[model samples]
Target: MKEVFLSTRDFPVDEKFGLVSQILRSAYSVPSNIAEGSGRSTNKEFARFLDIALGSAFELETQLILASDIGYLSENKLQEIQTLLQEIQKMIYSFKMNL
Candidate 1:
């Protein structure tokens, strides 16, 4: 997610409050939700948080695709983020299942 944030540094200033913001918020949400969820007293609560994180991941994925399509991101960079997103999704799913 830090990488994603950094990657957006070169984005046009016009997008500073648009696509870039969305990407950053979505990237940050995953961990923020996980952290918030961990403080919950119940697995059910944590699972719900994971669901929110997963949703953010999916949203981020869509934004990334848009970034790539609009030429803001390179195919290689996009693939890297996509692969990481997949890994994150799998890990979150596994954690939810374990709960």
Candidate 2:
């Protein structure tokens, strides 16, 4: 989340309400959903939240790709973010399956 914010700080002013906003929302959504899910009373409910988090992770990945395509992010930076996002997605999936 911090990384997303930091990276977007360099984006064009026009993107403050565009790609940057979308990217930040999606990036934060992943963790927020996960945290929300963890507090659910039932495993099923938790799994549902994890599902949402996973979806957000995928959404964030797409936004990152779009940013790269637009030259807002470098290949290296995108790769770094992608790697971390993938790990988070995998962890969420695994935890959900166990639930």
Q: Best-fitting candidate, measured by TM-score?
A: 1
The stretch of ten residues in a row with the least summed lDDT in candidate 2 is 1-10
lDDT of 1 by residue, 1-99 (tens): 777988899788999999999999999999999999999999999999999999999999999999999999999999998999989999998999999
lDDT of each: 0.94, 0.90
TM-score of each: 0.97, 0.96
lDDT of 1: 0.94
Off by over 4 Å in 1: none
- Best lDDT among the predictions, by candidate number: 1
TM-score of 2: 0.96
